[model samples]
Target: MLFVEAKWLYNDALTFMNDHDINDYDSKTLTVHVLDKDRQPVTHELRYLSSQMRQSVIQGIKNNMKSLATLRKHDRKTGSLKYKSEYLSINLQQSGVTYKFYDKRHIRIQGFKKGIRIEGTNQFWNIPSLEFANAKLLNLPDGYYIAITTYQTKRSEERKYKPSIGIDMGIKTTITVSDGRKVKVLVEESERLKKCQRLIARRKKGSNNRYKAGKLLRRAYQKLGSKKRDAANKIVHELLEHERLYMQDENISGWHKGLFGRTVQHSVLGLVKAKLMKNERVTVLPKSAPTTKYCPHCGKLKKDITLFDRVYECTCGYREDRDIHAARNMILLSGLSTCGTQEINAFGEDVRHWQNSAVQPR
Candidate 1:
């Protein structure tokens, strides 16, 4: 009843916003008419949704309008907010006031008569210094979840320092590190997922059986997403252990139109790249840096190298694996020149002389 009423409030608010000017929204006088399953309007009062929840829904609409205005200010195309067919999230504006922890395994939310039992409270139960803030109640395909924002004092810890490394993201191998390490993270579709998809396709549309199949399909996709997230987190954590990371902002999106699109998607390269890019220690080079074309040993850019060239062989007798060579260039270039440097030879190095000089600096 709570979620159903919340959805009705949200759709009603959205309809009101669309019909009237922005300056005409009034919370005191705004009333919503409920609709039955037959698509007929019926008279009803906003009895289920609390005053705070109603305000939150209206505020959400205003926030979307503000976002659209900001996009238009930046000369980008914008569109109006669409009415939501379902409302899966509700904002708990205050932690202890709107919602409160009844005990270690139960919670009480506003407008609800009974305390709801929850399962995931054990992780934060014994923490003394934890402070809870606003949270969102999420109705997912699997079950209901509450994402809480918490704050605590930072604990200082010593970290093991390792040499800086550069990474090259690819479809063949997910990541090629400058230190000759290749990590492949590919989560192939499981048999269960395929079976679920096939079952969903065979169901008739608008039937209860079809709805059940859709749920199973959603669960399968959710499982795949969890695997990708876990892999990405582990990879990013390992990369951040280094002092610095250098990578190029390759066009992973454009790879979707190529022959290896499925391979790239399944390997989760985009997720890894996104996670790494968020870290302060990671330096991203421009797309035109020519990390693959330039020879790190002789500082020469070879223009004829194609994707088929697995080995990067330069005219100056420098040879290495294509991806590793590119990864090494990322470190060398970033060490000499700042990110976004345009010239290919701006910080080119002769590998032999550079190593000798490093070994015996004058």
Candidate 2:
């Protein structure tokens, strides 16, 4: 699949007439909806919005551009960036869209009939998704440009095994699998974000420089988020290839409230939680189940265990790495609970154990 952006089509329409007394750019607002490959809406409110909303929408694009630029600067190796700097690609909130890339010519943005020609002489790195979606519109704030990019999708190889696994997510590490495996994906704190944040913090509240710093910091955060999302996707794909999986009702939010607060605040656990919940083969254990506190074999509760203790050593001679033990317990617990019910919510139906919260549950 190609990475294509829908831009400029509405820019001319948004321009104001010089003779008109009214601000045409502000008055003539339009909203655009995203259509799927089959032209169905994927989002509810993200469809075409007013020009003000569109300007705000461009902030998201600006965020993406800033992030790409930061990644290009810091993630470069051997004098080359990990992600190419030649093309700045983004997905506008518009719905119903699909695209294709060809070797000889320009990128064809779906929905619109004509293809936007490719920009520059940059080479295409062979990636799978290029067949359906190639980078078409290299976008900048001033005007539309052509972009060349790579696309990658899962390979066509057939699966030979039927094993599946469930996970317990945590802040210090990425995930704790039920099979005694701990996948610790590390994220280095963004130095650029820190610098921007510090600069913004030191400036006067409403100054232009302060505003610029805020934008830069926000971009740093956006880049950090993208990196995390890519990592989560790769890990989730690996977990899903298995035949079955058992996952826990984890306390990701509680972790965010405690010490190491900022470090784990915007953790990948949220993305992992989302990915596992959507998978058909994954069976979820109730969030209240004490995967960390309860023993898998003897059903004993180790109330004294602390977060600093990396290993789970119980009085019953049960010894395992803390995350691994929790992961295995997740698989075991998945079989005993209702689809979304956790032990905390296992009380009478009238009690309503689930609190009103915005948690991204697993």
Question: Global lDDT of each model?
Answer: 0.76, 0.55
lDDT of 2 at 122: 41
lDDT score at residue 41, model 1, on the 0-100 scale: 86
- TM-scores of the models, in the given order? 0.79, 0.53
RMSD of each: 6.3, 15.0
How many clashes does the backbone of model 1 have?
0
How many clashing residue pairs appear in each of the predictions shown?
Answer: 0, 24
Query: lDDT per residue, candidate 1, 80-184, as tens digits?
Result: 777566788888898898789978888988888899998878889677699999988887878888899998878778877688887998647468998888998
lDDT at residue 219 of model 1 (Cα atoms): 85
User: Could you tell me the TM-score of candidate 1?
Assistant: 0.79
- Which prediction has the highest TM-score against the true structure? 1
Q: For residues 242-315, write the lDDT of model 2, one tens digit per residue.
A: 77777666677787786767767556777777777886667766666666776654566778988788888877
Instruction: Find the 10 residues in a row with the least total lDDT in model 1.
Output: 353-362
What is the Cα-based lDDT of residue 334 in candidate 2? 48
Residue 114, candidate 2: how far off, in angstroms? 13
